[model samples]
Structures are given as structure tokens and as C-alpha cells.
Target: MPKMKRGSEIPHWFPLDVAGTIYPSARTRNWNYTYRSGFLLKEEVNPGLLRQALEDIHSRFPSFFVGVRNGLFWYYLERMENLDIVRRESTYPCRPMNIFSRQSPAIRILYDHRRFCLEIAHCVADGGATLTMAKALLARYLQLTGKEIPPDSGLTDLTEPPKPEELTDSYREFYVKKVGKPAPDANAWQYRPPQVLNYLKVIHGILPLEDVLPAAKARGITLTDYLMAVYLYAFYLAVPKSRRSSRQIKVSVPISLRNFFPTETLRNFSLFTNIGFDPRAKADFSFDDVLEAVKGKLAAAKTKEAMQKLLSSNVAMIQNPLVRLIPNVLKRRVLQIGYVLAGENKFTTPMTNLGRVTLPPGVAEHVEQVEGILGGSAQKRINCAMISDERFLHIYFSGDTKRTEVQREFFRLLAREGIRARVECNIREEEDVE
Candidate 1:
């Protein structure tokens, strides 16, 4: 590994990515848009070695090792010198972060028993970047434990200096002038059950990938398409029949631009499209009906041309002269109102699939499970994220509502299809028992 440098020696500040600009403004005292990505190892974690690994790998990921700062017109990132941020899990995963405090880093390195997790603020980076950092950290941790993990794309080699390309904000790089912005979406149906203040209930449905993969293939759709269909169907079943026609049941699925654009930037490079149908329009929609709708929406939205328009729309907003002239103080309020008017309310729930996670043979051997967890918002109280290994696809639902009807119905639908899941949660046994 290369020797570490003092923070002053390196570039000390960075601009927020186009997608990240909205997160800081949307944050409240109690909640922020955060997500977690990490692995559950087969053996108990050693905190000493884990902390050492974090210190060892910190310099290699400059984009992630920083704190948020309030600029005159926008929020920016200022690098933090302290690397001793690892700690035992003392609170729930993806809890609110103190990003404004220079003393606090935007990312959390947490360990509990055999679980090693990275809880990151969305303002720092997107899922793809966070996953890369998590893989590198896991590899470093294992290597420190005397494991001979070979270099792979999944793991960032600590020996090399941070690349300039990894820090580029690809949105501006690829934005095209005159590209028309996509149409705005109507407000979708919201499942606002009673709140469980400050508490996030997590449920993991671990299913064999073999069963799930064939199920998707049999339907002639991708795994994401299959899951989105089941998710919409679950909502249809969970909600009362009387309320089904209230509004569209839209699910926001984030599409990584790395798949479409040629960029290695670790910053946020993704945009989400709302995929759903109006229950009023399709009065008697079946599973097959929902699957076909999801497929059509995904097919249209996932194309390079469609994504470029969406990306340009986002970049265009920030580039507007009127938007740029607003001071940071009022800009916060404007952005907050804009988010409420056009953001979270437009989607009933968000489901992100990190796809298959591959680790080097040496590191994969020590890992038992890997999954991604999305944080719930005040408006969209229930959200889902999934990541899979060769054996099992781990579907995690993180919710702040008192009810679990949506989650239960989702897993039940899978069970009815002969796809069984081993369920787990953070709630008490008494509370979780049906």
C-alpha cells in the first residue's frame, strides 16, 4: 500500500454532483437521504483490524473521505483529515448523519458481530460508488487479517493514487444543449400508515437465485422487471380495494448511467424513472398485466436516448441562470419546496437493485451474505434495495411505518410461486409475529 498524505497536501474541496445537489437541501433534523452497502462475514469482526483497514484505504477514495460544507450558492465537500471513523453499531443502520459538522464524515464504517457495513449519505456518492468503496474496504480488511486477496475490478488497489476521472461529475460532461426535458409526473398514491418515529424496521427476504432467476427468465423479463411486477402486485393486494383507484401506484427505479454512458466517475451518475400504471385505468390488472406494464416502461426509460434526455433535464435545472443566482440560504428553501412538489411525492416507493455483487475468490470465501439497504423517507415510508451473490438474492425492505402489509404480501407472492425465502428483521419477535 502507498503511504498516506496529510489532508492539506491534497485537493481539499469538491463540488456536489448534479444528483447530489438536492440531498442537502432536502435534509431535516430527523431524516436525510442515506443508504447502506456492505457484507455480512462468516466470522466475527475484529474492530481493531477493521479500523486499521479503514485508515489504510482512506487515501485511495478521496471522493468519499470528506465532509459537507455550505457554500455561498451551493453545498460543497471539504476533505476531513481524521480517518478514525470506524465504530461498533450503536444505533440503527443509515441513521441521520451530521454532514454540516466538519468534525463528522459523510460516511460511516460500522461493525456488529459478523456484519460489516458502510452507511453513506447520498450527498457523498451513489450506490455504484459506495459499493466499490465497500468492496475495497472489505478486501483491505481481509488482507490485513492475513488473507491473500488478489487484485480485481471490484477491489480498488490501495497502492495506486486516486484517479482524476473517478472524481468527475459525469452529468455535466455528457449534457447536451437543446435536449428537451422529460415531462413531469403526476403525484402518485402514498401509503401513509402510522409513523414509528425515529425507528426503521428492516426485513430481509433471502431467496435462492436459481429459483428467482428462472422465474424472471420464464416471464421473458429481467430480474428487476419481475421484482417490480411483484412489488406493484403486492401493493395492489395490500391496499384496500376502495382506495386502489385513488392514484397511480408508481415505483421509482434508479438507472445507473454507467450502464449507458462511458464514465468511471464515483460521484452520483444515476437518474430514476417512475414505473407504474393507474389502477383506475387498469381496473382488473393481473400479475401478467403488471409485468408487461413494467417491461414496457423499463424498455422505454432504459434506452440511451431516453436516459440522455432525463440526464439533460437534471443538468439543465442547475445550469439555469435564475437558479444559479439564488443565494444558498434561500436556495435551500427553494430546493426543498421544489423537491416536495416534484420529487418524493411523485413515487410511492423506491426499489433499487444493485445487481449481482462479485468479490474476489479470497474475499468471497470469508463472506456469508451481501445486501444493500435503502433508507425510508418521511413521505415514502417504505423503500427496498436488493443485492445478490451466486447463491441467494437478498431483498431488503426498510420502512418507518407501523405496518408490514406491503412486505408480507411481497414475500407471500414469491412463496406462492414456489420461491421460498428465509426471513429476518430487526423488530422484536413479539412485534414481528403475525
Candidate 2:
């Protein structure tokens, strides 16, 4: 096995793996997703203990310590000089978990400037991997602190993971190939608010996950319905009169396909379901009535036909090899047109309910709670995320700087409605970095 390299070898391979010859594997390309959280440590983070934790991280997701390419997806698994993995450190800058993870490897760890806050980036693991790493680290901390026993680490339960063939290979093929697109030289996203006075931004705040559902029960709606109502209502009110006088607006709510598909793996497994509100119908409606409509839309988005059609669209794309390789430039152009056609007619924001996080018991000694943030390539419309624990909800709002003010206000409005939500800003300029 080759040793761990210090930096990423972007030229390692293309359209195949460097580690081995290409196989007709239907697995998705190793895409990158950033998941990070902040937590307080009762004590200072000891370099030694932290180092041990980093090694522990490697034991499970070691592939993260190495680089990946279109074909071969692995690091030299052998140890170098009995001290380090092959091709150890290159030139990636130092991150929070610099000792075990690469500064520029597929994965990274960064520290929050102000506190013992740790932010980890999992280039390989998706949202599911983030949760897994967080749980593992939390549990290890408990052990280091001498607080609790090791949490259950069993994955032998052969019950989950969707069947591979069942996945829409077309979606997998498209998503990765799209990544190969040569991003603009500036790397800056282009977006203009509908108008100066009319802006749509993410609202951040935590609501008791338990409270949300119970509150819905009282109102005879599901938690998803109640939250959707709030989001759609806020969005409708924000529409400029110029636009309000015209068409409908919809929100792209994402639904996870974990259960629907037999696979429970960390692979990308989500589909967007657009929900729209007709101003004519909603303008005269009360919040309760809107809630009912939201509930109905949520129900319809999950029907067998909805998913089947979506799958068909994705699968159809894979059947065209020529279309898949039309160069990233052409693909971006296609996407731009597609985005235009989709219009701003759907939901103005993306709200993802990570749902209540349940970790294996005894992991983080004296466990508190775990929450995360969701940021995307687009700098416009904020991506709002909420994850709940037994009592508290962790809400994260992230978007381009242009949307900050509105995001804060949205949280304030939620609190005004007596929902007991707290907004925490993760702005680098505003907050002290660790």
C-alpha cells in the first residue's frame, strides 16, 4: 500500500480510481459535504487526549485521512516508519484535528477560535457520517473524562442500507459529474434579491423537537406541517408587491429516502419536493388554514408516484453517456437554464429537519446535545437547519452575507410567537474564532 500523501492529488485519476482498475460499480462518486458543530468542554482540550481521539476517528473512517479521485477511492492503509500512515502530511493548512486527519485530506478538523469548539469536515461521509463522527467523538470524550462506559459501536445489524441497485443511478452519475464542472474563476455565486426591499433569507432558532410535534398534536397537525406553515407564511409575506401581484412561490422541502429505500447508508439519499402557496388562496387564509394546506402538500410529496417519477427522471439521464460528458461548461449552462425554468415559484427557503439526534448511550460521558449547520454553494437564500434533542432544538441559519439581517429577524419572529427559540450566529466576522 502506498503511504498517506501530504496533499490532495487532484490529478490522481479521472473517471476512475487510481488504486485499482475501473469496475462498473454503481456507487456514487465521493462527493463532499461539510458538517460542523460547536460544543463546550468542561475542561481544556489536552493535546494528548485530542491526539488519541484523532486516531480513534481514523480507526472508523480512515479513508478520510487520505485523498480521493474519480476512480480509486482509498489511502495507503499501511503505516509508515511505524509512526504514521503512508504519504503523511503534505501542504494542507493545520485544522483542529491536524494530528490525525490531514490538513488538506478528504476530511478536516477546525477549531472554533473562541472556545474548545471543534468543527470537522467530512469530505466522504454525508450528513449521516457527520452524525456518526459526532457521536463517536462525544462518546470518546466521556471516556477520556472518565464519565461513562463505551457506547455501543455495533454495525453488525445487517438490517439497514438501501439496496444498491434500487438507487437511481442517474442521480448519482449526474451529481458527481456536475462536480467536475469548472467553477467560475471567481468562485463567487451570482444572486440578486428579487428587490432591495424584498429579500428571502434563512431563519435560525431552536425549538424543542418534542414541543414541535406536541404543539402540532394540539393543533391537529404534524410537526412537519406546523413548521412548514410557519416557513410558508413568512415567505408569502416577504414577497414584493410587484411579484405578489403575479405568480405562486414554492419551497423546496427535502425528504430523505432512507426508509423508502432499503439502503440506510450514508450515500446521498434525498430528493427535493417543491411546495408552493397560491397567494390568492393564502392571502385570505389564516395560519390554521395554511397549516392544513402544508400538511396536505407534505403528504402528497411522498406518494409512490412522486418518488417513482423523480427516480425515472434521474435514471433516464444515466442512459445517455454522450449527454453525461458534454463538458462542465455545457452542464453549467444547462443547470442555469433549468434553474430559471424552475423559477422562484416554489418555497423561498430550504428547511431540513435533521430530526432528534439519538446517540448510543454512554458515548460522551455527560452528554449535553449535538447540533449542526448546513451551508451550500449558493450565497443567496439561507439554508435553515434544525436538530432537536430531548428538550432543546439546535437551529442553524447560514447564507451569503447579504441575508444576515433577515435571518436574524426570522428567528425573532418565531420567538415572538412564543415558540421559545434561540438564535445562535456562527458568523466568522462577528464571533471570535478559536
Candidate 3:
């Protein structure tokens, strides 16, 4: 790993990673790409102890505690000093963050009752990195509360000094020139419902792993592949029959580079592969058909070589001399346009599975559950994200539209496969209102 200043000696400002560069420009007046992941503890949260725990682990994850600043030619992260970090839980998850504010921290630490939530801007880090920090914070909080949790359970040791590799930009480090970029994709079919201003409805399905794993194993496919197939099929059922044959339905699956590369950088280091089927081509696509398509695409796209090409393409954009020289003001517009044309427009929705989460033997006993939520955007109005604990997989579907057809169909499909999920939501119907 490349070495750099550690702990208090680390620099206060640095450039955003290859993946981080686009998020700053993609933000609208009301939204940006932010996500939430948190833990449900066995006991109610103690505000004073949670605050103290954050302060204790604050210096360890320096990359996450900084604010976004505009340089003449680019956006960079500047460490915010003496800023308050923790807050009371809001009614909704992944609310738009004010990263433009000088004093705003890069991540939000929120707690409610027994839940400890971390909301992170995509520019600062990806889900994998956020989980690392969450593990550390939870461990420290438990330790402060008189638990004997070991740091070995994927938790960063607060006693040890921070590693330089943890703050490095792994995407740039692993970028390989001369790799051919992947073929372009067509615009995907998206579900559009009337918007609910400033409102986000979150629905969670708690699926038992024992019930779900056998279904995936029986198909000889990974859990992610199975879930992606289910997600796509759900969208397929929701599409109007008239447009089903012509419209292409795609779900973007994010792959963590850490799986293919050797690095521990907590910053964003992942790429997405769009997987779906064209009904025009398949004619009579079945659930099995969707699963086969997802498995095949994932098998080809998840390789190190394919990811290298995607990573190189992203890095090459930032390296362009002309692109780098464009003033920040104009660059933001160009990037936003590029995002619509090359990013969200190409995928119907994103389904990110953070995989199984484990805790120390002692910590495990105190944790009740773990969950993650992918915030919806203007274009991708509904998004899905999930994380699994020892016994159950918690899937959260968050949407800003008034419709729940897609979310309903997703869990319903799982149920048909004999995989029962305990479903819950935050929305109160109009009739329920006083």
C-alpha cells in the first residue's frame, strides 16, 4: 500500500476519488446521492454515550468527517474542525444533506430509541466503507456502555493508529490504462408515479436467511444474483403490457472493488453493472429467464478485467487535460448532463446488497438487527438496498412517488418462492390521517 501521513499528521484537504467527482455535480437544489445503514441494538440508545462514542472514533475515520469544498477547477474534501456530528433521528431516512454548507459534516450520525444510523454522501464513501465506520462506531459505543467486545470482529481498533491505506483513493491506485471500455447500454424503462413533495416512503422486508439461502443455493446462484432477478421480475410485472415487449428493464448492481482488488481504502471504490432483459427478445420471459440473464451478466461483469476497464474509463475522464481545466461552474453543468445521459438514464433502479454483517461474540449478543436504505433520486424515483445479519436479510425499498406497486411485487415474488418476509413501512394512508 502507498504510504501517507497518519492520524493527526494527515492533510486537512484532498481531491475526491474517481467515483466521488461526479456526485458533487449531480446534486439538485433538493437532492443528492446519499444512503443510510444502521444497527438496531438490543437496548435503547443512550444519547450521551452515543455522542461520546462518536467523538472517540472521530479521528479514526478522517475521510468521512470532512466537508465538500469547491476548488477553481474541481471539488475537494476539507476536514471540518470542531463540528457537531450526531443528531436525533429524522422521520425519514437518507434525507438530502447540506454538503455545500461550510460547517456541514460529510456524514450524519443519527440515533432513535435502539437504532444507530449513519447517513453518508456518495462522494465521501460507498456502502462498504460506511459499514466499516459503522462497525467501529458500534463497537466503541458498546464498549463505552460496558460491553466487552473485541476489535477482531471486523471492527477498527480505537487503540491502534489509523492506517494510511484506509484514506487513500483505491480507484486511482488500481486504474489500468489501455483497457477497453464496456459497450454502451440503451435507456432503461422506469416506473413513474405522481411525486409526493418532500416525502419519502420507506418499506422494509425482513427475510429469514435460512428460508432465502436455500432458494438461491438450489438455483446454483449467489444470493445477490437471485435477489437481482427477483427485483427485475418485480419491475417486469409492473410494466404496462403495451410497453412490456419494447421497453428494456434494467437494474444496476454495484460491485465492491475490494472483492477483486487488495485495498482497504474506505473512500468510494466500486462500479455498477446494469443487468436486465428485453422482452422483445425473450418474448415469454419467465422468472427463471431473468435469473439466468442476471447470473450470466454478473458472471461476465464481475471479473477483475471488466471492472478494470470500467475503473479506467472513470479515471480517464478526470485525467483529461481539457476536462480538468474546465471551471467548476461550467463543469457542474456538463457533469449533470453527463449523469442524465450516461448514468441514471441507463438504469431503471439500483439494488445494492451489502451482504452479511457479523459482530464480535459479545457485540452480537447486544445487536438485534441491521438494515440499509438507498435513497431515491429525481430520475430513479425508487431504489432498493439491503444488508443481512446472522439470521435475517433486511431489504429496504425507499421511494418518493405515491405508488408502491414495485415494492409490493418484489416481496410478493419472494413469498411465492416460499420465502416469507415480515414486511413493514413508514407510510400512513390518507384514510388513516385524522
Candidate 4:
């Protein structure tokens, strides 16, 4: 790989929506995200293959530093332990991508010494950037084996991924406006993942994402409006009832801030709205009604006053350095407090509509598929991640393993509705990376 140009580490910084909800989430989750991408290798990987792959990546994307401050800065301690590069393990850290740490552990490491996988800290790069790293890894591995691996290319080479940030950042301040305050109520059932994996089931299926989107357009609703409506139904069902129309169901959907707001492209570029359902409109609720309501809410949220209110709500609390210095245990307690304040009646689940996936004409020839993963943390119970092309509704989720059954039932619900299904799951195993 060629060396980076002088001062090549310069980055474009943007804000991340999750950064707003600091306390009620795991440090790894609050700040960073870990995800893996791999394939059943055409052949077994030689021990040396991954080490050289990472080394080459570090050389070019070298500024992968951590603990950055002042937005655009990146700080990397140049010692071996500082970055924690593992030759045998294929582990390394760069700068923080999301609020997550830089030198984080690899998610899909050398498990069983056979399965080849890579774990990435979201802080260093968003899913789009990380997928590029995976592509580089594959290209390098192929080259090591003396195959005719093509020259310098990857995910960026695939689709003109509108820096989702570019599209949304222009309206960063308007993020929380569309989200309504939840009406008072008793809380929904909450869940947390355990140390050991024990979910009822982990299943995945693909349908035409386009099909659902058009359904929204038909109703004059946006994709998010439609999906959030689905979650509201799921939330209603998840609850044990005596139907209380007064109960509020809330959801927080991260709004990309690249194009909406003005900012350098270095940091995370996203904002989110904590939207909720008010019972006054609940008794007559149907998906269509919910869709229209969400559209209205979204429109109001994009206004300037909405953004100001969101900023005022948390600005003072976070700016207090003492808030950042509290012991993590205490911090978690405070987070729970804020979470409860948002309303015990917050949405039962989070439906993250990741919009669409744009693919270059023939990239599928190289990669059979690329799935976007959305994992839930303490602040949210369940996450529904959707990525669509013209023909497929690609969906996936990660939550408390115990919720696996719930997810399965949901998938079944989708299938019964007549969507074609193609599934892939690696959750129920003693050895996962394998």
C-alpha cells in the first residue's frame, strides 16, 4: 500500500445523534459500536494473511487515533501497546469513530483459528467506512495468496453513498423538534442483554424494501413514518393490556446531519428525535393514521424552534464537566433517571429506518451481499434496522438474546404477509465467529 500524503490524517468532523443520550447507554454503545463482516472463505486463511492486511490498512488510514477533542483533532500514541495491533489476532485501534474508543477490540477475531472475521470500532468510521476496510482486507488477502486481486478499490467504489451526513447535517439543530413529549404513564417492560448469549432465536430474512417504501408513498408518508408506525403496533402488542390509550409509545430515530446542517465531515454527522405517541390520538389509531401523524411530527420537527428546545434541554447538563466525571456506576443511575424522565411510557422499541442502499451496477459480483447491523443498548429495547434497494427489504437486529423469540415472531409476521424471505443467522451457537 502507498504511504499517506503529508498531513493526510486531516479529517472532516460531524456530530452523531447518539452522542446526545450519553448516560443511559453502555460506554461501548454510547461512544462506539462493534460490528463484523466476513464470508465463508473460498479457502482457509493462512496465519500471516490477516496481519499483513491490517498493517497495510493502518499505513494508509494511519491517523486512526483516539480520544480526540475540539472536534477535528485526532490523537494516537505511537507505541505498540498504544494502538494494540495484534499480528496473530488481527486486532488494532484507530481514532474513535463514534463516541466509542479508538483502540477497541476486534469483534470477529481469530475464533477457532479458522474463521476469519474483523471487528471494528464505529468511532473510527461509520458502517460505510468500515465496509471499505473489509474490502481492503479481502483485496489484500487475495493478493497474499498470489491471486490476481484487483488494484486499490472498495465500498466507496460501489455506490455513491450520499454521505447520509451530507444530506441531514444541515438541519442538526432541528433534530428533536418533530419528536413529541410522551404523555405520562407507567413504563413499558425493559430488558438488558446478559454476559452469556441466550436468545430464543436469531433469524434474518430479506424482502423487497422498495415494496414497503411505496406503501408509504401511497399513503403520502415517508419510509420512517411507515416503519415507526410498525413499531408502535409492536409496542402495543408487547405490552400486557388493559389497553390504555393514555400510554405513550416513544421512538428515537437518528437523523443524519450531513446535508441538513453545516459542519466539517470528520466527526459523526447525525441527530435524532425522541418521538412519542400521545393517547388522545390513540383510541382511533391504525397504521394509516399513525403514518400521517408521524409525517406531521417529522415536518414540525424540522423547524428551528424544535431544535432549540432539544438543545436547551440537555446543553447545561452535559456541559457541566462534573457530569462527565461522575463514576460510571453513578453515571448509569443518572442516565436511567433521564430515561425515566423521557417517560416510562417511551416507545417499546426503536425502529431505525436506515433509508436505502445504493449499489454500483455490478458490485454484487464481488460481494454477494452487504448487511447493515443495528444493535440495541440499554436506552432502547429492540432495534429494527432496514436497508432497501429497489427489490429487497434487507432487515436485521441485535438485542438482549432473550428477545430472540420476539424477533422470530415478528419475522413470522412479515412472512405471513406474503413477502419472499431469505434468512441468515449466526446467533445460536457455542462458537459464533466460526
Please, what is the TM-score per model?
0.96, 0.67, 0.95, 0.64
Candidate 1 achieves a global lDDT of: 0.88
Per residue, candidate 3 scores C-alpha lDDT tens digits across 52-129 of: 888888777888888899999999999876547688886678888888778768788899999989998999999999
Measured by lDDT, the strongest candidate is: 1
- Residue-level lDDT of model 1, residues 32-82, one tens digit each, is 988999899999999999999988888888889888999999999988867
lDDT of 2 by residue, 1-434 (tens): 11233323322222211101111111112212244554434455454554555555443433334433321222122111121322222211112222223234534443332223234333333454456555555555456656655424542111222233322222333332222222111111122353211222223466775555666677777666677677666655444445454444455666765546555344345566766566665447556666666677778768655665565454445336665565544544554444433422333566677777765555433445555665432323456666776677776665533445445445545665567766544433444222
| lDDT, candidates in the order shown | 0.88, 0.46, 0.86, 0.47
Cα deviation of 32 in candidate 4 (Å)? 8.0
For model 2, the run of ten residues with the poorest summed lDDT = 17-26
Candidate 1 stretches with Cα past 4 Å from truth are 4-9, 152-154, 430-434
lDDT of 2 at 224: 68
What ordering of candidates by lDDT runs from best to worst?
A: 1, 3, 4, 2
Highest TM-score, which number?
1
Q: List candidate 4 stretches off by more than 4 Å.
A: 5-51, 59-118, 121-201, 242-246, 264-266, 279-285, 302-317, 320-346, 359-362, 404-409, 412-417, 428-434
Ranking by TM-score: 1, 3, 2, 4
For candidate 4, write residues 70-174 as lDDT tens digits: 222112122121334433432221111343334543233342243454445443344444445555555665567666544333332221222333222222333
Give the lowest summed-lDDT range of ten residues in model 3.
1-10
The C-alpha local distance difference test score for the whole of candidate 3 amounts to 0.86
Q: Among all windows of ten consecutive residues in candidate 1, which has the lowest summed lDDT?
A: 1-10
Candidate 1 residue-wise lDDT at 428: 76
